[model samples]
Target: METKVIINEERCKSCSLCVSVCPKNVLRISNRLNPKGYHPAELFNNDECISCGFCYLICPDAAIVEVRRPIKVKS
Candidate 1:
């Protein structure tokens, strides 16, 4: 499966809004801190993500760079 969300760690401000808004609960605050001394959000389970873009919309810092919907190929 392809990744649904792309997070820019440098731009993240350790906000939990994304985590709270994620319907699948795939996003989480990493234990590791970024260069700005903030715990950036990371994707824990890409397979579970529904590509709803909730995380992207809720992000105040615009850390989430991309939210992609899976391409369906007709057989």
Candidate 2:
């Protein structure tokens, strides 16, 4: 299964906490700003995410949630 991190822009504070803890460099600061007018965390390349949960674990804002892609099975 593939994994992806979904960021809640409303809750993020552009703290870059996730950017520091992410070993694979999955997260980055985007030019896009949230409603709060802060540039929050974003995915550089979501397909590379290993679901290490490092970002979620290190996030003080609880802004990131992980979603796993379902695998297909033969009938």
Highest TM-score against the true fold, candidate: 1
TM-score of predicted structure 1 = 0.93
> Best candidate, lDDT-wise?
1
**Local lDDT at 73 for model 2:** 88
Q: Would you list the C-alpha lDDT of every candidate in the order shown?
A: 0.93, 0.83
lDDT for residue 29 in candidate 1, whole number 0-100: 97
Model 1: CA > 4 A from native: none
User: Which ranges in model 2 have alpha carbons more than 4 Å from their true place?
Assistant: 1-3, 67-75
- Weakest ten-residue segment in model 1 by summed lDDT: 1-10
TM-score of each prediction: 0.93, 0.81
Put down candidate 1 lDDT per residue, 1-75, tens digits, no spaces.
768899999999997999998888899999999999999999999999999999989898989999998898999
